[model samples]
Target: MTAPATKPQAAPAALALADDALVLAQRLGEWAGHAPVLEEDVALANIALDLLGQARVLYTLLGDEDELAYLREERAFRNAQLVEQPNGDFAHTIARQLYFSTYHHLLHTQLATTPAPDAATEDTTAPDIRALAAKAAKETAYHREHAELWTLRLGDGTPESHHRMQRAIDTLWRYTGELFQDLDGLQLDLHTLESNWHTAITDTLTQATLTVPESPRTSAWTAGAGRQGLHTETFGRMLAEMQHLHRSHPGASW
Candidate 1:
């Protein structure tokens, strides 16, 4: 009798997660010396380092961490569009962080509680993913808190600050739907994840005294496609800058 076919491993999910962390780390790192205040520079840098560490673990699972992060072409990355967005103003950055870190924290929490994969019957990557999620959930809790506090401070601040915060929320609202997309390989239910995300975001926004933007109309264009490796126009420029050092130095490393 012919042997049963071996199911392919779920590399896409891992790659997507890795790319999200890696790209966001790079974006956040851009604010290292440029943050609005000295304390924020340190805070943002710490967050970036945490994300970079997560990316390294995820990338190591796939193969060479450096190659996967530095050598990938524009069409090869699988990060969400939200993370790759330009950090506009302080409010804009905080808004993006609030949305993503909340989602991340919730997702990791769920994953940590998920039943372990059957070693004999399922992909081995499941155990690794769960382990990673457990650790990451802790870190993301801090991230979520940081973003939430800032959201409140900016949203309920002076009139000008409030206006900027509200505008930031509205601008980034369109990109958010992409985070809830149902990908093929993830074990978690995307619909459930999205529901939790919405509830959490709504509650936080309400507390911040900020208006949550109306959901996009069915006919309106939503930004996604990153899971399928497509990215925004600005992503190319970001990629160029990120890869420059590695490309220029070749195999050199400190």
Candidate 2:
């Protein structure tokens, strides 16, 4: 008798989560030398490394981490458009981090606390995924707190700082809806995730004395197809830069 074909649905879901972490890590790493304060240089790098570690674990579960990260084409990436956005300024970076880390922490919390499937029906990778989620939840909590403090600092600082923080919040609002989009193979409640995210964001903005942007989360002009392999023009440039060295030195390693 022939063996049944193994279902590969989980790989795409894992890849999506992994891509989000990896791309955002790369974005944060770009701030290594450019952060406003010397301390921020180290802080941002630590957060980036935490995200990189999560991405590496997820990638290892799927396949070769280097090949998956370096060889994938732009359209092949499954990261949310929010994470791919340019680090416009310190405020922009903080806004992006605040938005994503909040969502990521909630997501990992759900994944970590979810009950494991029965042995009879469990897939081989389930335990590892849950374990990774558990560890990542702790790390992302710090990421979220760091972003929150920065948000408050910038939002209520001098006039220019307040203006930039508000602008960053408004500019990035549209890209956030995609965070709650359905991901295959994950049995999470999207509605709950969206609601919690909204509440958390609203509270933080209020505390910082910034208005929560009224822009629609999803609209004709908003981004939403990243999971379907569609990406923004800027993503293409970023991907090119990220993949350049690996492609240039194929099969060569230090």
Candidate 3:
């Protein structure tokens, strides 16, 4: 006899943002004991905690945070491909952080300031999203600054360091396109956000003496499929690792 079939889950905007934060938090947590310096160990841990906090808030909106984070299948995740990419080296990790933190900062800023349609309306979720954005925007500001400082240091430090920084930027450039895609619940004007993100990133790169990496051939017209639950192969392995312990012991808690 066949086992019971799994229920279908809807991919809402909050889930997408939560998955992005959760996946990236796990990636950052991997650097806990392995960071290049003691200061970075503390810094990265704090950033991971910040992302995990954001994920918890977002997950709470949907359902049980534990089950949503651990039990969901690979195809049900809605994070951008950029966050799921493996951290290749120090420069690569910084590059990823630089891109994503910048985007996150801008996105949250807009969400915080954008007024809801009707203040008297019964849609409480709008206020919650806005409130969360206000808090998250401040955290992401520090995250963006941390990445910016490291990018500058590495980009101009040495010939080898400069080369690696450039290479890292080029390698991850393709994944950046997916960050601007529209989501169901967020009524954001993505075009405006993308424009601001480009200016901010380009200015930072120039200050570091790094050229803006060329975008992928079709990136201007086409985006990655991460929002649709289509993720990179590495994401599957990461998901497995993240969920393994939780899956092994059903209902086990600290």
Candidate 4:
């Protein structure tokens, strides 16, 4: 896609941002035929494709097309710990989609305005970035809706489903903070982004009768350095599988 970094904003620091998208896409693909309902199965598969498409375009922005897709080593990968976390159950997968998509909507929107919200209409790239942002915004809206509907349905339905949903929230909830984390040269205004995200996520959860992870707990949660190429144990396993073919026969291409 050859995404250009906005004039006032620099390009992403690592291909790892794109790596996060790619890994989540792959993990979601695992549920293609196993969702509890037909509509859900279709929805999840489509979301997986959407994430994969974004990843492909983002990777192209970072470097050599073929190499970026498959040539990276495990220690070189840059996806967040949340995306790489195993899809433990149906509840877990749904929670994953919900949380990530909501964050995407907020992050992309904020990035779109980074060039100065007033300058947005005057800049030529603004039109293009705005369109891209609009598309992603719509997709994320649907993703959040689908995920929350599923969460509520499951959480409010049976006793077993309710328990599972809460457990999913507890385990997966901690990983949410890393999404809004801003680092040096990240091209994001961390404080502003964090405030906006807190508002958006809390409002969304409130409607679903869910609580945001308390700040103290989130504070105590360990931060994984996915952005810096540090990864959890399973992440290496995933990278190994994804990179195996390209590594075994470097420079051999179709």
Candidate 5:
């Protein structure tokens, strides 16, 4: 008997999660060469590089690395809603970064030992997936520190800054639940992961001497299937800006 012909497979979902880190990282890049303060400007740039590194390694697994970064349509992307939200203000930007990067710290830390079946788990995802994740995990550890320091400073700094920071937490907090929720197969929602994440975030807040605003009921959970090519309006803009070159020229090379 002859073996059946196989069709070419696309990128893995977990690798696509790396895309979430990357796109947000790219958005963070906008702050580069233009942050309010010198220290933050350097910090944002470093964060952007870390994210771009994560994006490059994961995308390299499926095809040409540069093409995936500079190419591909918006609809073709599968990054999460949390990654695409607008930066709003400095406090808002830092708050969102704090929320997501902390999760990145947690998620990537887990991935080193326990990865999605399709990601590094198969042992074919790439040596870089583990390596890059390990590196990103360390960078994220610093991010957690940055966030904690800033959260305390901003949360207690000045009346106005405190108000803005608190409001930032209120505004961005809703989207956070989406992260810990079970996207089931797309993410590794380990046994009791959601509760564990809550405890973790709470513990961080305790040390920061702040609290995660209690939403009336935790904004009705809206699950976005960014992994399935589903996205919010912001993603459309992100796509246009990120892929303008490849879309305009259709595979023209540098």
Candidate 6:
């Protein structure tokens, strides 16, 4: 007798990566008029646009970008929990940026430098992935530097600012491990990626006079299942807000 066929899963790498960019871009775009200064308002918006551009490229590689981004249910999104996290305050936003941009820069650097496997000739997505990685690496490098500078300013600035920066870093540290977790179709060595990320984060924190949290990044109590479609409570609300207009308009486009 023939066996029953299993359903195919979404392309984990493309979906997850694209979701990461999309979610974070939404979060950053929230700072439009609320940023601490006019300069920060414009800066965050530009960064959000950059991330949105990246997400569009990645989503296009998968299928209908609109359907994948706007039509998907909350549980279907595969973004890392870190990116979906609510941007608490200016310092908290900077902390999230510090952690994610560092990881993003490192991950894209690997993708840009690493040669595609033999199967890439047949896999049309490989070249696009490489090109996106190459382009995004440059963009994320700026993101990393921006985060690093802010982390330093906030962490070392004043007593209140320092305390807030420290608290933000500690609060978000647990969500970071998921960044290094294995994803399908990514051929880079996770060990090296993680090690480099650790060193970079450590150096930045040390320079900022901030302490790296002793808390574990992954554990039963910490978040790690986002790639498996699990997420925090905040994600549902954020998704609703992000998809509201798109879903409401249903194919209406300017």
Model 1 scores worst on lDDT over the 10 consecutive residues at: 1-10
Q: Report the candidate with higher TM-score, 5 versus 6.
A: 6
Global Cα RMSD, each model: 4.1, 3.2, 5.1, 4.2, 4.8, 4.7
Candidate 5 per-residue lDDT, tens place, 1-254, comes to 11114311223554466678778987888888778799999998888887887777666565666676666667677676777888778888878877887788877777666644655334344334556667777888887778767877887788888888878877877777656544323336555555666676677666555667788423554445566566777877876787786767876876
TM-score of each: 0.92, 0.94, 0.91, 0.80, 0.81, 0.93
Runs in model 3 deviating more than 4 A are: 1-11, 119-123, 217-224
lDDT winner, 1 or 6: 6
TM-score of 5: 0.81
Name model 6 segments beyond 4 Å from true.
Answer: 1-10, 120-122, 222-224
Worst 10 residues of 4 by lDDT: 6-15
- The local distance difference test score of each candidate is 0.85, 0.87, 0.86, 0.68, 0.69, 0.88
> Poorest 10 consecutive residues of model 3 by lDDT?
1-10
TM-score of 3: 0.91
Per-residue lDDT of 161 in model 5 = 80
How far out, in Å, is residue 226 in model 2? 1.0
Candidate 1 regions exceeding 4 Å error are 1-8, 117-122, 217-219, 222-224
Error of 1 at 155 (Å): 0.2
Candidate 3: C-alpha lDDT: 0.86
User: What would the per-residue lDDT of candidate 1 be over residues 2-33, giving only the tens digit for each residue?
Assistant: 21154337567778888999899999999988
- By how many angstroms RMSD does model 4 differ from the true structure? 4.2
Error of 3 at 27 (Å): 0.5
